[model samples]
Target: MKKSILAIAVIVTLAFTSCTDDNNPSTPKSTFELKIDDLKGDITDGTVTLDPSQTYTLTGALIVKSGATLTIPAGTTIKTSTTALNTSLYIGVERGATININGEANNPVVMTSGQAAPKESDWGGLVICGDAKVNTGDNGTSEVGGLSFGGNNNADSSGKINFLRIEYTGAKFSSDKEFNGVSFFGVGSGTEVSNIYAFESGDDGIEFFGGAVNASNLVIVNAYDDSLDFADGYQGTITNVYISGVSKAGIEGSNNQGNDIATPMTDAKLINVSIVKGADAKFTAGEQAINFKEGGGKQTYTNLFVSGIDTFAKLDTGSGATARIDAGDFKVNGKNFVSTSNLTTDYVSTETGAGNGATLPTWATKISKNN
Candidate 1:
């Protein structure tokens, strides 16, 4: 009887399964638990709402094209195949598309690997592309998907993502193009992003490339590379972030790769950040907690707490970065800009208090206990 019931469920899944590259009504719409298998296409101009009570499998790239939306309710679980080749299993929302993840603090949406003992690089992670401002060009190609992004609108809206957890992701597309836990490419200020957690990512936990989207209440644990990375003329604000057990820098910032003096230079402000390296951390010989390289950007750090790291801040001398430090363009610890030579001696292993009255969110308290 049990075998018969399982067989019936498999038949129902196959009967309703539909896979296509273009927009059409032939796609499956099932209210019951749906098993998406080997789906190698796009969801164009349509909507896919996952049931919170059911579990879904993603075996290939699930691209939400223009005018499409993918909605995940609270307490939803979406697992990606670990055996997929060449970073196949991932989610990509293109320009004009939206992904509404309405997860609550107690019932957050979870996206993880399908393997039993999941390790790093199990699958590709989430990718969001928007038509916001970027120094790369009008329509620059993204590093992971080669999708076109970037425009003149600084207020472009991709959608909302809240109370989400991504685990064991960051599959490499190529030697130089590896996916982050969450990649925001040219995303804008109109989008709402908060309460995100990335765990055990093979690459960076979160990366913003040429975007103006502000984020808050972020947590990263056991990241193989930098926990947070900002590049390509990003002009966003980050608040209340915590990073632990990072192999590389806790925060890595850079301007445009091609043109160092690009318009809207990477001017990001970080508040109430804490980077703690555990006893068994995997840091390199000369790794720092904050590293700014390939400059022509302005960075402001306030009320930061960094401990158990070899170096606190490492600012590259090229690209006039040292000049920016002297000109008060980069502020540290609520003080005027100063030299980077004393950053380690001044800030490393120090217990700097929180920013003003900043406090960690409730969700962060629950997640930090596990790390």
Candidate 2:
């Protein structure tokens, strides 16, 4: 007689099973339990907390499926190893899932490469997907993980990220499909993100895709692309940002390109920011301090201080962008050090913002942990 498959469930210590998320009840994913020294896989249920004393290495993709939470204690370090072409080696939280990175000011959580000579694009980076609204198609899919994101819940909570530093991230899988140092896909304002640092990313330091999450105290260093980017009808409020050594624009804001008249256009409001044009001339065409294109929506920058290079604002030659700007929908408001000229009338000479001029902000002082 053949043994029944149900009989093996009671005797198995580590059982492999399929799980369905509440967000998308039809989609199924393989689930597994994470063990020390090997912290990667689909967490399907409950909350798993990492021991700060033990060492953890991410060898593959760690997906926190819906209805699960992954908690990293303060002073925890998660070293990662990845193949040159495999961008799937990342930590991602799906819709209805949560990841709590609890790092302190002095003892922060570090996520970096484990190679002897680590370089840029060594591995993929952190990705959080929530059910927040987006102007994309019915659902937006991520390039790195192929996960479906976007919904109508603007108050959805993905979780909290605090005092964490991620280094050597932003792996590229294709010409257009690449990873940001930190990517928030349709995340909501209920999530708490603060004191995060991005160092030496191959793409943008941090990116938000049609989310309402409010992020604060962010620092990006040596970003290969734009330091900060938001598109697809994102309505988020970011505060206290410091960027340096960027090969592209300091900030890039846009909306839905396919459907420029989509509901709830992108609204970007930032305060106390400093963007310094670095010496990385590898991309000479990347000479825009702030670039608004593709149906650019309302953007307000307050107490902004920019040093090195000129070109305060540059608008792309998109039909939707031009129409939006002409209609005052892409109006720039706020007091800043540089004069945007025709872009904004609210310009003032600002010596420094975010409590420090072009230097690293005090809130992002935990960047030392990743180095």
Candidate 3:
């Protein structure tokens, strides 16, 4: 036989090319090289879910592994860490961790900072560590300075985040301690963050500490700080927010220990919100708009549409700081709260506070066009 049929046809053509390279689905068995200073430590035990129409392109810093479940499917483009001290993505989620970034709103799923034009310290965003349960000071000091970060044990829907779009993040190391494009420390409230967008941030583009979560449609633009910040005792339910504070100012709801030092107890509930201060230019100290602080407890404002310059709203050095305002056909607040929060809305007052250029109080324009 001709060398036994050429050694059985070269072992059946090497077993049909090894079963066609094991049924190639673009075959990539192992080539792991996740770098960016190896992404700190234990980002939720390494969970990577994605794959919902599959498209992942992370260059570095891709840590999400606690109880492992990082599913980001909705146009995914997670690229960061071009080394500004290893930029962005430091999501340290532990205690049975989980991260399910279900993006939408025209396929929104991007946690960027691998800079081309990125600014705001250029990196670090989206840190959610929720065990869910607060008020730790009674023998259960619960590691704040030591920094384990994450609540006691509560909010459980098995951890889910919704319709996201985190852009141009805040990535500083000092001075108001940057890095907040969506950082919900101690995130409880049955963990399911909502329609989020923190664009062009430098800091405070969305922060809720001491969790009891209930967020809704937040959109902050050009932030430097305070585009919606809540501190210790963050008993939450922040609704329909739309902030356009350009150099910072437009909701600095605080209990402030800087943000965490057991800074809870601000019990929040703001609805149909709209804060516009220095919309894009003008800053002296950024200007204030609805700043309530320490000695905390109590916040309930309905239908607000601020147009700012300076002090459109104020409450910064706390003591019996309780809020309950329902300025319905909104325009800052009756008689135009000191000429519509005076930094500049073309001042000297003519008063038209909502919209039609300003004047939409038909149930606050049907609750701002049904949110």
Candidate 4:
């Protein structure tokens, strides 16, 4: 009864709230009386399912608090405000909350900016926090929205995420702090993610801040920052990742930001990963395909291929990080991306190579921007 009441209350609020914003005439009040922009605040109970037929314009934050679920069905399109530096508009699932995005490969859920000509940093992206182990703390506060996450539940499930495409995300807060196409903070193994495509992100395409969520079939294109990043004691198995046109390291595998010897450690595995750097790709020193730094922890790479990048891997020689390397805890099985790719080595195997080099992988053809 409480769940039904809560769901009905949300629908009522959306139907009644007058969205006439005198300051910004472009407010969603002009379109429909059931202003989708007014759908903010905490969903403390019940499951709120998004309608695939009706369009959604997110003007503010939509938070799914604990014990709540937000469902987005197949072909659901959600557009956000295009105002520059607007980081407040996003979909965040707090600890104990669930987000079930039911999207098919051909008819996937799409989220982008509502501007006339959308570009990067148009709005924020999906941020999911869970009660998983993190080296940061018991409950670490996230970079965006300052939401609390992390706990002792390694099997905690936030929900399912698959066949979702996020474009032009990564709103900046500071030089070092910014949003990504998807930020998984302390997410656990019970929550599965697959077929996530991130395009033209202003920051990292996808970043895992201390989680044990095993994901696969991830594709990133034209990311302004690192294509993939994992840190803060993240222990997950990421497979079948295809990355290209990245500005920084294709994979920034770090343990922690400031503290090198944080508890737990960012120990993860990569299987059948491909990072292809374009000819025009530019990167700083030590920013290559795989960069192990900040006290990098244990990692096992299998069938990890790199092409068009001169350097394959670089390790931070910092005292803390060097010690970890010297102790045989971290090693880079990197080899040049050349004709001898299929030699069947421990690392740098191009057998599958995800897809055609420097292009979208075959598994991501159904939901790709190029298509």
Candidate 5:
């Protein structure tokens, strides 16, 4: 009877221990890696709305195909992968695709690099291509993506972008093909772009490649290249632009590479612009505020204010560009055009008795002025 009782007690103790062990395991549970759908491939033929609650990662080139629309709500933050030097993570809207960025002033849509230490050219930037007019030919190939753009339609609509900010963009693809912060490839006037800002772009802040899109309330800060670059017969009108701390010219204009005398020239008109050089800028001795390379189009500059720069305007050695300026094709109302040879290292102000009676934009109260 004693042996039986001892065996029963041992069994009971073992059972209780087993139950306790089964209830609470000693080894911790393994955590599965959180996976998300990577937005790196083509978005073909559908309307995809990005949820503001969830974060999306861009690994490679995200192409919005023709006849598709990518709708991004307000306060949507897109993070890019930082695995390599040239990750080429970008959002490209094709010729017929549409991108509706409905961001408010308080909650602006931000597309930035995912690198822990973000810098310029960390990844590619935003690209929008449309069927607008261009001088490169009928649907010419874009320099950045080799995409086709340009058509007979001057009012083509790719989409609308408002209250959007792009940071640390302008990844270089090749020796000659470098991306910009925002590249408008044949975008038309029907596209509404306003309240846009580009910060620390490795290349140009905003580049228009043969488009008729009109932009307003644009701001560019610390762009390594030109602040605003218009080339390949861009005929857009810009109003109330602010550029600060640019490495290259504030505005660079060119008609076409092959033929500077190309039709549908880059005839952009600037109404109110302010360009201020940064304190840490290393501008060369002969750099111009505005550089008109080759045979640039008949652009007009009005109500311009520039400071902290040595030179004013540099017109390249082209007879076509000079003749156009002389014939009032390239008109200047509040500022005088300074060629490369006659560039002065003196600060010129439009508000302080310089050229015609032009004043700063009423909305540009935040910008610092020497006048």
Candidate 6:
């Protein structure tokens, strides 16, 4: 008779499992344990470096406290649990707090939602907080200093994150607010974020609270919400972004509902960005490719290619919302915006206010890659 199939309950403290070539039944299973206290001094208030050879799983919240830096080496896979029973990894840097996470292109660091195949809901997202400033409107959330951090000051870089891939993130918060694949809250201008990719995020791929941190080489796919949402006066430039949303048919497979705000802001200077709209059929009238609310900062576009938009670009809710069209672009605020460069628009809305019909700047004609 075949040996009885038994369900063994083995408790591994480190919350990770590895494969080996040994076949001895008598050999004890290798186990790794890392308590919060074990990483207390190393990560809480000091520099913590994760070993490239070791696979570490977070059992509770990983807090990168104020005045500390946590560095994660490349080719590291950081996994989290799904159920609420285990605390999620929270990297909230308080006032004057700092974190430096640097990864490479070929060997990028991955922060995922859960270890399992990723069910309906998995885990929380990455939050980078800095000592920058924000303007959260009259609701009084703006007065808080640490509310919006990341900025564009290269000299005083506060938080640094690069070449990071975040997958299956954007946890829900009371149905109204949800976690972003990457959340930059009050991040200062000195914060450096680049070469980041977000896949299958339940919320916004990347949300900026306030600051001037320049980001480039961003890729968002199958995100439930907007690709990039900037609020509270973000004054940095974003380049080379490729955002593609899931089609309407795939909406049923989505983990979260639809996003109230989907389109990117009209403030930051975005060049060479491609936004793929909803593939599903649940789009409301307000869903647009680029929605510039009233009161938003001045914005301009160049070498932009748009497909699948109810409206290409429009100013809706904010004040001072203006999007200057260039020759190298397409529709904006009901005008046929175009660029003299080789750039072209495959589709232009016949709606009167579909495009603003403006000329693109000369600098936009150059297609040189950014540093």
Best by lDDT: 4
Please report, in order, the local distance difference test score of every candidate based on alpha carbons.
0.79, 0.79, 0.56, 0.79, 0.76, 0.51
Ranking by TM-score: 1, 2, 4, 5, 6, 3
| Poorly placed runs, candidate 5 (over 4 Å) | 1-37, 84-87, 283-286, 334-348, 352-371
Candidate 6 wrongly placed segments (more than 4 Å): 1-42, 85-89, 119-121, 137-156, 246-267, 278-286, 317-319, 322-371
Tens-place lDDT per residue, model 1, 148-221, is 78998889999999989898988986668899999999999999999888988889999999989999989887
- Judged by TM-score relative to the true structure, which candidate is superior, 5 or 6? 5
Two-way lDDT contest, 4 vs 6, winner: 4
Model 4 agreement with the true structure over 60-170: per-residue lDDT tens digits: 777888887888998998898655346887889999999999889888899888889888787888899999999989789989978899999989999999899999898
Model 2 ranges off by over 4 Å: 1-32, 82-85, 280-285, 329-351, 368-371
Worst 10 residues of 5 by lDDT: 27-36
Each candidate's root-mean-square deviation in Å? 10.1, 7.9, 18.0, 9.7, 15.0, 15.7
lDDT score at residue 90, model 1, on the 0-100 scale = 86
TM-scores of the candidates in the order shown: 0.85, 0.85, 0.33, 0.83, 0.82, 0.66
Task: Name the regions of candidate 3 deviating beyond 4 angstroms.
Answer: 1-33, 36-61, 67-112, 120-124, 134-167, 170-182, 185-203, 212-228, 231-251, 254-287, 291-309, 312-371
lDDT of 6 by residue, 250-314 (tens): 11101001221222222466656655564566433234556544344445444555556544544
- Residues 46-141 of candidate 2 have per-residue lDDT tens digits of 778888997788888899988888889998988886443448578999988989999888788888887788877888999999999998854888
Superposed Cα deviation of residue 359, candidate 6 (Å): 26
* Reference-based lDDT, residue 322, model 2: 73
The total of clashing pairs for model 6 equals 44
lDDT of 5 at 89: 80
- Cα lDDT tens digits for candidate 5, 111-153: 8888899988998899999999899876777677666788878
